[model samples]
Target: MFKLLFLVLLAASVHQARPDGRIVNGETANSMAVAPWQVSLQTSYHFCGGSLISPTHVMTAAHCYQRFGVTVHFGSVSNANSPNVFDVSTFTQHPSYSTGITTDYDYAVIKMAQSASMNSNTQDIALPDDTDYTGQTAQISGWGQLSGSGGTPTLLQVATVPIVSEDACKSQWGNLRITDRMICAGGAGTSACMGDSGGPLAIKDSSGKWVLLGNTSWGSSSCTTNTVSVWSKNANQLSWINGQMNS
Candidate 1:
């Protein structure tokens, strides 16, 4: 059911494969929390991953669906054990997505033909509302391998990191343009890596609700090292996301 294979291309010098590290089970850390039944989008065709954002919608990096026949599985933490699989019915890459830059807007939404069944183990995550994530700490989760060398973890893995400013990210990346269309977070040598892409970069809202601030984007070559994530904080994009969920 992968539909847009022609569009997804690997970024040059970008470490698209998972890294080698010890298997760390999911846990709560600051604003990061793992949702039950969240699955990683792994298939023979592509090495990237995604998260189940709702009963019918899965949030992932737009680059992950560039391959045809890519399959996604839910209800399991390990890639080998996940038997509940679904075919993507529709793929929607953000209209502004471009691969020209190092981390150009890389978010996308996938619609499955059937709705996912939610239980205590599985649930939809809340989206952030007009909240400034700058200077706030966030968490990211994924079932992908610990490092490029380690196998996919048997349980979900999560890590804590603080958000960075666009100016800081651009200064670090040098030539790349860190625009207002994106928000960055990381430092203190803790960050998300290859397998964490398209996952949630979340923060707590004023109401104590865990709202998604960023879809895991690219980062440094390693996870334990300092990393920066590009987030979507534009008002128009936030409204568009709310509209999608409500509609």
Candidate 2:
């Protein structure tokens, strides 16, 4: 989690539920048709978000991996419950991931103990290619918050905003480097903050299919501020993800 305390050292910029909160200016999604791949990472309560990439695997942020028990809830949009639930069979964090002001390689994958049943209500999202996403509208969803303050909704929240260019993102972030392996979206008013770590940030393809582009990692130091949120670009780690999922 990014700590306000982290401003002193490095962990200061990472996002979380306590201070980072959830979606700002988003709508409640109660149907799977909206985010069929959405996965709520919970430990008694929703702590983070994720996306189903395959029947047996999920994509999320490295920091979301926990040694404690975590229930993966999906197949529904309700923040409180879902028809699908799984105990983690594996939690694979990227080898290079670590928490810092410039959190690098923040992506990770989770393997379910049992494969998720495929249906209209429950499905996996397609992975992204290296194609440019500039100016494309990115839809990010989570079970975090509506207004910034610490409160989660009974339904999932989603915000749609255009992807920002690397240069512009770098410019806004100032000294912090915006690497090629990352993707930035949400600026000005609408953004995906809250406790949205590991949630999916996607764009509809020409066919109107949702393609997974990135996973929520960190955002501005404050959620209420109109700051750009960052994600672990999926195109940069397709090989590693496939390898891990197959293993």
Candidate 3:
């Protein structure tokens, strides 16, 4: 989760409920079969994660912004070899998003400067759906850190976590109120860590296609296991995303 807009987008803002970019207790991913739509949002280095929603469009967290520019890299699990890259043609965050917290309207859209090259390992994920997904399991992936102080992985890392009930999710968040716009997941050894902001938290649909459900927004300060990670819900943002990304 992307913790908060915390200053320059990637520093201390990540608190008890902060934006993060890591996969704890996750396995090295064979991303082609499991996470083809995943992309590393890089600028000098890998800073965040995102999902391809169309050949020229992407979905990410608003807090993953860079003042200069960002490049989208994909088509391979190993970050060292991801050959396809594209400059952003446009970057749009929900108009109502705030800086205090990276929850609610923390989502954003990115348009590649040109049509992206798609292949067996590089493709688009399903557009978001209307389902609540409160009790279902979803997959989380990224090239962020392996732990709070661990080295970031060169290969993609993935973990499956069950979405926590909204009530349970809120209770766990303590002072940071869990809004309807935030979907909660991960309360076990598997959790997200720093650098995983703007990444996807998704589930397979009836057709077995991964559908975007949430965007990593924030997590615990230590990114320890058993801490629930928060996501920016996608269902409520369908109209907003469809209208803005196409505009």
Best by TM-score: 3
TM-score of every model versus the real structure: 0.76, 0.90, 0.91
Error of 2 at 39 (Å): 0.5
For candidate 2, give the lDDT of residue 226. 62
User: Considering TM-score, which of the candidate structures 1 and 2 is the better prediction for this target?
Assistant: 2
TM-score of 1: 0.76
Candidate 3 C-alpha lDDT tens digits along 17-123: 55566788898885566888899988888888999988888899888877566888888888667788889888888898765533557889998888977788877
Off by over 4 Å in 3: 1-15
State residue 122's C-alpha deviation in candidate 2, in Å: 0.8
Worst 10 residues of 1 by lDDT: 1-10
User: Which candidate gets the maximum lDDT versus the true structure?
Assistant: 3
Writing each residue's lDDT as its tens digit, candidate 2 over 1-247 gives 1111122122334433122336778877757788889898888988888899999999998877787798899887785768988999898999988555466687889998999999887889999888898988888888766655556676878778789899877766645546767898888677666577888888888777789998887765556446677788999999999898889
Model 2: lDDT to the true structure: 0.76
- Which model, 1 or 3, shows the larger lDDT? 3
Residue 200 CA error for candidate 1 (Å)?
Answer: 1.4
